[model samples]
Target: MSRQELPGLPTEATMLRDFPWVVVRMRCHFCRRGGDARLAVLAAKHGPYVTMGRLVVEFMKECAWAPWNPTRRPQKYGMKCGGYCMDLRRPDPPDLPPGMQGLQLIEGGLSEKLPAAPAEFERRKRVGSDD
Candidate 1:
């Protein structure tokens, strides 16, 4: 299914219990921080149902690069912490068939059509008339 077909943020759908690996690996390239935690221990501490995204947030609270950290220093250009779960990164969109080409409509679609004005317009015109 496409990303849009999913019911919630992709991360929310993945819980701590979804990982099959005994060790859950997390890394942040910006800060050069990496670690591996026992899956069972993580689940026990954060609860099995906590999302990988939420867990990452809790783990990166002390990182200077974390955008959500209130005490983080301001930078020339704001950069979010590149923290990620090794097991749960989103997969690339599937390639189209060899003979098929992708197409996107930029304009002139039904979504651009506006509804007709209500009868109230006639009443307002009568009220404003000089005659």
Candidate 2:
């Protein structure tokens, strides 16, 4: 079915399903700028739409609060599983340090970035260094 068939759903759902990756719009509460978030699903490995839950959890966890749901019971307790509503996963951007907006514009770098692991040398150097 055409995306227009679903009037209530967010505009990104169709694109999300089609692409291995997509730049999602997320609100930045501090700068009032929109952060271009990225999402990907590996259909060959995980099956189409299968990673939606895991991605949802990761999204919520990054936002530092559980997903807020109004329809489920216990209305007082905030947050619930995002379920199939991957579009619903959004955490209001908290106040961030200078230049700390989610994804950043750079002079000599790529527009897209992902969480990275430290270099082996750096990782070894940082061992219990904070202690």
Best-fitting candidate, scored by lDDT = 1
* Per-model root-mean-square deviation over C-alphas: 12.7, 19.0
Q: Number of clashes in every candidate structure? A: 0, 1
List model 1 lDDT by residue over 24-125, tens digit each. 777897888888898899988999998888877876776788876778776779887888776564442223364465565577878877868844544445
Query: What does candidate 2's lDDT look like per residue over 18-128, in tens digits?
Result: 433344444423223334444442444444554444443444444423444333356466544332332443333323365665685566545556549855653345567
What are the lDDT scores of the predictions, listed in order? 0.71, 0.42
**Superposed Cα deviation of residue 7, candidate 1 (Å):** 14
Look at candidate 2 and tell me the lDDT of residue 119: 52
Residue 130 displacement (Å), model 2: 92
TM-score of 2: 0.26
